[model samples]
Target: MTSPFDFDRELAELGAAHLLRRRRQVAPLVPPMDLQPDQEHLRGTTYLIDGQERLSFGSNDYLGLSQHPAVIAAAQQAAARYGVGATASPLVCGHSPAHESLEHELAALVGLPRALYFYAGYAANVGIVPALVGKGDAIFSDALNHACLIDGARLSRADIYVLPHRDLAALEAQLQASEAPRKLVITDAVFSMDGTVADVPALLALCERHDAWLLIDDAHGFGVLGAQGEGTLAHFGIVGQGGVAPEWQGRLGRLVYMATLGKAAGVSGAFVAGEPAVIEWIMQKARTYMFATGAPPMVAEALRAAVQLILAEPWRRQHLQALQRQLREGLQAAGVPWDLWPSDTAIQPLVIGRNESALKVMAALDRQGVWVPAIRPPTVPKGSARLRISLSAAHTGEHVARLVEALRQAA
Candidate 1:
């Protein structure tokens, strides 16, 4: 039986390399309001990890609407009406009014004609990619795209050409070379690990020239970038059909936009927005969407509230920008012995060259009552292991100062 698969040896190897992943039971708050983020106190951003309190920089709740009174109230109301679970697939009576409303709002926000919601970002990508492209097609992917996108490309059974990250010339050349029946280009709007943004307008232009489909996974951009928090498209002034703003528009030929609500929106689930016909095609053909149970109606309602908060509370984005500058300036002044990679977004990566060293830094911060995740390969490249410090609007200036001080001590 091939030596019983050698589970123990494989696990031991993983452990030895400082890459064995483990989960600590994390309570979202430090007190009895544990399930909720305490958004009004000095300990507002604290989390109870394995029963120990730690000021955390490990969450993607960028706009901090997860525990807003309005969001919570909306969820409570929906749960009272529809119960907690969606109870069925969207095709089998699970697509409720809340979901439909949320989808419409999402489409309009992104300037697309329609949108389809998914239970998670991963599911959306893995399903949408294969739904629209298959064996005879070709997919051009960015090297640093998220795992979900990579998995989707692999599953599509299409010819995948992975160009170097952000190498537009190489991508163009590859597109020029591919003579497949159909061509698709896939990339992350904001790379998860490094926090660098893709040149989306240029990519879209290239796709148009080559008559290819462009898919942008905006997991890290939605609710974080743009004047109205409309994600990366808004940041670059690319508006589509049904988009109300008179933002800059190009020939937008064929594009598919996907963004998650769980990150900056501070809720659960994701949505794919594009032309109505394309969305209908995905809904009709995607196995993940057709077979899986929909997210609860309460989640849909909560996301509605989150969407409103995103549009109404401009201060959150402004405050976030201020905090980013503060953190960057403080760290540069401290001369911390690691590279703080450049980013214009909320996700900040401090690159520590070796795996063990990154973990050491994480441990040091943890000991100082602060928590940031040590991200190692295969999440990142082998030598570029880092502590991915994610900030949120819930965090205060004092919180940033505390983290800076702790890092200075660790250094």
Candidate 2:
């Protein structure tokens, strides 16, 4: 039977390469909260369970609302009112008032004509792309776009031109030679691994000149950027540019934005805001939305509350920026080798040259009661493994200091 597929050889090679991942089970915490003396797991922002403490500097809960009282209360109320599951797809009997309300709120938040909800960020990207662009069309994608975007583009059956990361000139050259009537340019607002913001203004400028459609996945930027957290478009002054804010009924001119509620918003869903036609087409044709079961009513309620909190609280973003600056300054003072990551947001990484070195440093930090994960190859480029250090507003000055200390020791 083909020599039993040689599973042992592959496993051995993966172990040798330091690419094997394992899950650590943790016991639940008791009162007078503390991490387990020899900790085994994590809960929310902190990395502890019983009586020990582990400073956590690696989480995407930017606003620390994942366990917020309001969000929990809202979800509980929703579960009571609408039950536990959606039970069907949106086109069936699953679309509830909660989903509809969130859509309206998101559309208003992003200044768009309409918005559609998806169960996951990957599903949102996958559904939106192929539904809009197809056989005779082409999608110009960034080389560093997330795996979800890459999968979605691949599924589109359209020619994909992967321009070099942030290379606007290369993109222009590709567009200049394009002959497709429906050319869509897809990019991430902030790259996941590098924590770098896209050159959106320049990209939008090029889109205007080329007369192409622009789609921005703001999964990493939402609730952490802009005046009121309208994401990258607002952060770069492109949405309300030149004293012209595109109203609900504005023409399908250029920009289309998609954001996920799981990170900064501290919820469990994703949404896309764009021209009415584009969203409507996704509703009708996108297989994920049409065939898959909709998100639970409870999640929709939680996201609604999360959006309100994002608008109501501005200090969270401010605290995050301050924390980022503190960490950067501390690292500098200690003479640590690192990169700025081209972002002022929560996601950050310290490049470590070798995979084994990265794993060893992460293990050392974990032993010293610090929990930061090592991001290795496949997630990043070869020879570019790093410790992906994420910051959250829930962290205090002491937390940052402890992280600096842990990094020093690990190094």
Candidate 3:
């Protein structure tokens, strides 16, 4: 008889395929005693792994606000006052003033009337999708949407039509043919792995024509795009200072905008913002939110501070853009022999085309004190394995230059 599980065989298969994933134990940077009082408060961007300081190009701290003194102070004050845990689900007694204020701020920033917080982005998507559509309903999803959205669609038990990545024609064809009573179109604002942005205006127009609801998970775009970091909608001028334009207001009832805090926001948790009634419905229905304990109040407070920083510090976004240009130009000038994906965002992929080759390049970069992870199947498609170089405002020109030189040498 076969054993209950074939764990050993699975492990061997994964190892042979060069698909095994591992975690690196990293140490946070500490300020040197020799630094001045003001300088000492600045957060160091480098991380120590295996007793070596490596210039990390894998972080999601886009604006470098994770260690900002104001964010830290806000977190500290909240933790001291509210302790480290909510100790109950939000529906119970877990909802705190911090959570409430953060939700309001997030809703305002995204130009939505209301917002509901969740423990994380994964939970938010999983909860919201199922709450909105199920059984006889239909969910039109992008082929390359994040796993959270995919899982949510699966859990909803709806007829899921995964149109080819960014193929608006295919999506429209499906929308035109679907007979389901409720149709929902879900997509990521920024494709996380490839870093390509979705055309929100086009999607909204399609949704309107088909009488469908649009749910955008702007996890990577929030705090990294637009003049005020309002995300991809603002990047496309679909939303303005007065909020989503009056023309788009008719579809606002069905627009569900979700974003994660842990990435560009430099904090924890996630939120779903939409019309008041839709948000209220989700609050009453999303199982993940109803069952799980609320995120710590301190994290919510820190996120509030992060929002303020994202709004006030426009220079940070400008500097990040500069770094992006520097890296792209340097890579082109160096003539590195890899297929670089076209992306204007923080994520830049150097496609190596084979799993082993991507791994070899990553190892070579590691030897040169540059830390960029090798992205392989099933994170990306087969025959398109790559080195995902994630940039941040914390990185400098020198850091980017060093990375370019290392890539040249590695290539």
Best by TM-score: 3
Candidate that beats the other on TM-score, 1 or 3, i.e. the better one: 3
> How much is 183 displaced in model 1, in angstroms?
0.4
Residue runs of model 1 more than 4 Å from their true location after superposition: 1-4, 30-39, 42-44, 240-250
Q: Mark the 10 consecutive residues where model 2 has the least summed lDDT.
A: 26-35
Query: Which lDDT tens digits does candidate 2 get at residues 70-186?
Result: 888899999999999999999999999999999999888876778999999999899889988998898999988998889999999999999889899999999999999889999
**lDDT for model 1:** 0.89
Error of 1 at 271 (Å): 0.3
Residue 52 in model 1: shift from native, Å? 0.6
lDDT of 3 by residue, 32-120 (tens): 33336655322446778767888888878888887777888899999999999999999999999999999999988988889999999
Question: How should the candidates be ordered by lDDT, best one leading?
Answer: 3, 1, 2
Q: Is candidate 2 or candidate 3 better by lDDT?
A: 3
lDDT of 3 at 153: 96
Task: Give the TM-score of each candidate.
Answer: 0.96, 0.92, 0.97
Give each prediction's root-mean-square deviation over alpha carbons: 2.2, 3.8, 1.8
Residues 1-411 of candidate 1: C-alpha lDDT, one tens digit per residue: 558789998999999999999999987664423443434753337878998989989999887777677888899999999999999999999999999999999887777779999999999999999998999899999999999999999999999999899999999999998999899999999999989999988998899889999999999999889887899988887863336345334455488999999998888999999877889999998888999999999999999999999989989999999999999999998889999999989999999989999999999999999999999999998899999999888899999999999999999
How many pairs of residues collide in model 2?
Answer: 3
